[model samples]
Target chain A: EDKVVQSPLSLVVHEGDTVTLNCSYEVTNFRSLLWYKQEKKAPTFLFMLTSSGIEKKSGRLSSILDKKELFSILNITATQTGDSAIYLCAAPNNNAGNMLTFGGGTRLMVKP
Target chain B: SQTIHQWPATLVQPVGSPLSLECTVEGTSNPNLYWYRQAAGRGLQLLFYSVGIGQISSEVPQNLSASRPQDRQFILSSKKLLLSDSGFYLCAWSKGWGIQETQYFGPGTRLLVL
Candidate 1:
């Protein structure tokens, strides 16, 4: 069975703190890993990591993939209340028409 | 630029009642469309996907059914609603057939069943 697991299901931190969210997966054929941020109703695309050892960054957010360990991590630096949301990690299920298999997600709360 | 739209931002339905949710995309053609449901504080569960017109692929078997009537339009319908069916429904579109593409999601429709 292919599944993705996230660590620290919920976290609360003060503004300006740095947080690392983890995601590990076990799948038959791994193609790519994606990260999304869900604020209220919709989830916006954050980053997509295909090759290991390559880091993808946008502003204060960064992510890396470790295929050997079957895991990925998302780091948010200089956190603000605007960054509070549910972070989701997902990967393509190679056996199932490339359908994405998503992790349970990590709820992040940045307090001022 | 591509955008997806979902109707009836919020809906309150009763158990055993019918359901009809619509999603349409603009500025793109022959794009891959997907429908997903998210429970409160939970991850997304893919319900259906369409590669092209008149093509519907279901990821899970449930009370819900989907249809792609046009190139950029996808619909999710249920003969009868269930309490468990209430959730946030989202529609997404990707550029091509490959899974390596990035998916853009709509604002989403919140369904509450009593």
Candidate 2:
């Protein structure tokens, strides 16, 4: 079974604080890793990591994938109240066409 | 710009009742569509996916089924609803089927089965 596990299921931080969310997975054939931000209803895309050691960054958010260790990390720097959301990590199944396996997600609360 | 739309943002239904949820995407052609369910405090579960019109694939065996009649329209249906079916249903679309592309999601539909 392909499984994606995330640690620190929930976190509370003050504005301007930096947080690191972890995601590790076990699957048949590893293709790529992705991150999403869910506020209330729908999840928006964040980053997709396909190569190891190279980090993908956007504004205050950045993510990196480690293929050898089968893990990834999403780091949010200078977090703001608007950054409060559930951060999700996922990877596509190699056998199934575009079928994604997602983590439980890390609930982040940024207090102003 | 691409956009995805889902109808009936919220729904409440009784057990054993039939259900239908609609989703449509625009500004894209022959995109890959997917249906997913998110239970309380759980990860997203893939229910179904379609690569093109009239092509549907079931990722999980459940009371729900999906159909893609048009290239950008997908529908999720259930003949009989179950209590376990209550959750946030989401629709997503990607560019192609070969690579792991970023999926654009719809606003989502919250279903409550009594």
Number of the predicted model whose lDDT against the real structure is largest: 2
Model 1 alpha-carbon miss at residue B2, Å: 0.5
Candidate 1 residues lying further than 4 Å off, grouped into runs, are A95-97, B97-100
Model 2 over residues A8-112: C-alpha lDDT tens digits? 899999999999999999978787888999999899999988899999999999999999999999999999999999999988876434778899999999999
State the lDDT of candidate 2 residue by residue for B1-114, as single tens digits: 999999889999999999999999999898889999999877798999988889899988898999998889999999999999999999999885444377889999999999
Worst 10 residues of 2 chain A by lDDT: A91-100
How high is the lDDT of residue A32 in model 1? 85
Q: Report the C-alpha displacement of residue A10, candidate 2, in angstroms.
A: 1.0
For all candidates, state DockQ relative to the true structure. Answer: 0.62, 0.69
lDDT (Cα atoms) of all candidates against the true structure = 0.90, 0.91
User: How much of the true A–B contact set does each candidate keep?
Assistant: 0.57, 0.69
Candidate 2 global TM-score = 0.95
lDDT of 2 at A42: 95
